[model samples]
Target chain A: MNKTVNQKAWFLVLPVFVVVAFSAIVPLMTVVNYSVQDTFGNNQFFWNGVGWFQELLDPSTELGGRFFDALWRNLAFSAVILAIEIPLGIVVALSMPRHGWTVAFSLVVMALPLLIPWNVVGTIWQVFARGDIGLLGWVVNHLGVAYNYVLDPASAWITIVVMDVWHWTSLVALLCYAGLKSIPDAYYQAARIDGASRLAVFTTIQLPKMRRVLLIAVLLRFMDSFMIYTEPFVLTGGGPGNATTYVSIDLVKLALGQFDLGKAAAMSIVYNLVILAVCWVFYTVMVNADAEKKEVEA
Target chain B: MARIVLDELAHSYKPGPKGPQDYALKRIDHVWRQGGAYALLGPSGCGKTTLLNIISGLVVPTEGRILFDDRDVTRLPTEARNIAQVFQFPVVYDTMTVRENLAFPLKNRRVEASVVRRRVEEIARLLGLSRVLDRRANNLTADMKQKISLGRGLVRPDVAAILFDEPLTVIDPHLKWQLRSTLKEIHRELDLTMIYVTHDQTEALTFADEVVVMYDGAVVQTGTPDALFERPEHTFVGHFIGSPGMNVLPCTVEGTTARVDGQTIPLAGAYPDLPQGRRIELGVRPEFTTLAAKGAGLPVRVKRIDDLGRVRIARVDLGGRPFAATVPEGVAVDGDEASVILDPTRVHIYADGHLVAALPAGATAA
Candidate 1:
């Protein structure tokens, strides 16, 4: 038997390439144009080559002052979100019923929060965390704990984290649930026959089987957390001080608040590059882990 | 190994069975000997699988007492019952290596690592799975994965029994034969109590020493293959246990003989007393029915012929009811007026859905 290679399949992908180039490349070119040039009131420009990037990288310069801090905070936030959401999601999914009307009911209820728009989630939490009238704040105060989210840095960070958990953990849970549901009941029966305890079943059978979806959940949560804006901005406004000021919030403050187009454009590019680099690392790690798993089996 | 017993077992999914018709599995009293091979054979929805699951402790009987060597275990969980079960589909751990899948049961029981390794290796060799021991089970073919599932069930030696619920339905036809023989060999080597449930007559007939034929949630007959064939206690057993099934012709009995379609076939013994004008049916296996020349036997019209290599199965019309007869190749019959003869001693008469005659011993058509 002889192998046949077909080259015409490239035609099927041409439309996608054109669409991506138009959407991504065009905006990226515009950002590059704004980054290196200085502009006055009326479209006047001057080439300031690599100066903004250097300033943003320099620790001593005022322009670079909060940039590195937000970057570090974004990284830490993404890490913590992944660490918390993945496990919590898995626990909820494991606890779900395996069959019947209860399974369908749980799935629908769990998926409800994921369908809500992100900005609306921020608004809901903003009103829900208010000190006097808010249910959570009133309950905490009634228990004799001094609770003020907008005034305390730790409280602000906690509120943002809780808000994020409430909004996005459902997505992870739903994905993990789908993964778990796809597994045949035969595996559980086999585990039972093998005399595997509940813990062993979870660790050996459930966790490893859910690895692919777990990777996807981690990647999605990481990318979204790294670029988080609306929820934290509305909840704490990256305050009390810069405790919850993630990179996206800082970027918006730089570009729109101060209107320093050159510096903000440079910051935007750096910020986008950071997100791209981190996402690439995550994607690479996941792909490499899958490849290594396949290699060992082979 | 332990002898298992079910005493007064009856199950109903609802609150209570108002009558016998509401019960999924009627009150069953039976015993399974230690180290014996048995099969529960029935069609779909016959409660064979339900009974097997009950024995495995996966499903609790609604009203019953299950005894394992005189110790009651009816309410015990599946894990506490010490039984291994192979489901209809392959259920190996996709992420674990084949070796890990086999070792899971042994490790769960806190078996020593060295012993676990030795036992896993032994079972892998037995199932022809040694080559793929280190490979992830998900990558294996369906049949190989099913073999791993079977291996997992057999890996634990201390289990009271191994229950198989239609384990060969997913297997390919050619590989099914090999697996069945391998199972038989394993039974001999391990001396394990095995209860295999299947809907296939051939598998049950060849695999088990004793076959329990069930219908409508009750065992119609339990006997050796020969006994089941020679003396079926219920009409369902006679119809179910044979290939092409048994042909049951409507008939009315008068004294010690029955008239079938206008011809008289002799009865073996006195008929059971029944109300006059009650419906009766006579059953005879297709293999025992002989096709003779025209005018020498009960007339039948040849509808179609299925020549299956060694034998020919002729579909015939007898009194407008379709019936099948197996005849040896090279038997010529007139297409218009073919006559088929039912062996007198092999004929079974059924009244009110129960057998009424005991056929003479060693009765065979010449």
Candidate 2:
């Protein structure tokens, strides 16, 4: 077969390249430039070359110590939220109404939290969980438990995780619900005829059908939870001795509050790379599993 | 392994069905002898699937009861009924191997592992799926998946009956014949009561020992395929069973003679009292009605001749009404004019779409 080489096709891709350059590549390059250089006011810059990266990597130093703490904290938060959210989302989806007007009502209610602004969610939870006059706080206090997010680090962590779950689990549920809806009625009927128990049907039919949607849900929740900022910042402000100060919040503190330009830029690059690497690992593992199954079939 | 009986079963999708028309399935009473293969044949929207679901306990009848060997199971759930059903589309667990798919029913019922394994092997061999028993069901072809569905149903030894609801609708045309034969072979070998539902006449007629023909939510006729072809109990059956359906013509009956458009055709039996003020018609299949030259019998205008590979069918106009009659080979048509020769014994009288069973031979009509 003869292949045709067309140089003009590159022109068609040039427009997209230009848009991406301005939108992403250019800003990322600026951050890279800042990471390798030191700047003192009046726009004066001196080459630091690898110094900031080296300092960030060594946890013994003050900057590196804070960065490692925040990184572990962010990873823990993502893990905790994912462990709670995925199964909870699936259970919520399974219990949702399959038909009637109530389906619409429940869907709208599930979507309401997702529609609320991130900072607004934080603010609402902040007040709702207060120890003073807030409903949750007053209720918990009256119930003989002392629960104050402002004073207790564990309470602050609980509040943020709960807040994130409330805000984002709906996206996972809605996706799962769509997956559940796509299954033909025949499968259920057949399962019934086969004398499969409810649990068996769920494991064999529902879970297999929901595989793709659940993959998407896990990836999205992992990425979003890892990079979480506004909600926690508004709710706890990484307070109570930096107990809940995740990486993004700490990064903001370094760049904007402390004005540690080179260190912050370096941290930002490392954070972006970590997310990219984690996502790549997830994709590669899933794709390899699928390929292995195909090879076994062949 | 059980004789199934539907005693006055009926169903309606509505909460309160005000009249018969409101019912999706009209009243039906049927007795399926144990080990007999039956086919519920009907066009789309004829409630064949509704009746099948009711038998399998997927649907509860609005009235009356179903019995399995004299056991009343009217309100029983599907799992309790011990009947397997293969749906219109293949329903296999996508992640499971073909062996697991076949063994699922037995395992679900908590059968012994050795028994489940043996049953699964027998069913896989019967379905010509022995080689692919370890392959994932999701990767198999649609027909193979469908066979897996059938295998799951067959794996259970305690199953009372197996119901198939248009299971071949998704199969390729060439594979349909192969799968159909496999089903027949399984039925013969297992001696299981299998009720196959389909709209295709060929599938119903070929697969079933006795075909129950449904029309508009009612069984119009239930008999052997030959009986259905030879003597249709209703005008709809006569029309539905044949390739070119039975020709029904508006007519007036006077004793043994029926007058159609002022021309008389002889009848085998007398119909003196069909009904008063009701539409009476003559029903005769084109296979029994032959086309001939103009001077042979009742005159008709030959509209066209369709050569159906083996037999040529003459589409004709009889007194301004369209009609179909078989044109025998070597009887070449020279012009538009022709005559149709009706077999007297094959002619039937219908009143308001139902057959008027001819008064016993040589008996006077009351």
lDDT minimum window of 10 residues, candidate 2 chain A: A289-298
Q: For model 2, report DockQ.
A: 0.64
The lDDT of each candidate is: 0.85, 0.93
Return the top candidate by DockQ: 2
**Predicted structure with the largest lDDT when compared to the true one:** 2
The interface RMSD value for candidate 1 stands at: 2.5
Global Cα lDDT for candidate 2:
0.93
Provide the TM-score, chain A, model 2. Answer: 0.93
Predicted candidate 2 versus true structure: per-residue lDDT over B73-141, tens digit per residue:
999999998799999999999889999999899888899999899989988899999999998898888
lDDT of 1 by residue, B216-243 (tens): 9998899998988877888898888887
Residue-by-residue lDDT tens digits, candidate 1, A131-176: 8888988888788988889898877777888888888898899889
- What is the total number of backbone clashes in candidate 2? 0
Docking class of 2: medium
Candidate 2 local lDDT, A134-221, one digit each (tens): 9998899899997989989999999999999999999999999999999999999999999999999999999988988898899999
**Model 2 CA deviation exceeding 4 Å by range:** A1-14, A289-298, B360-366
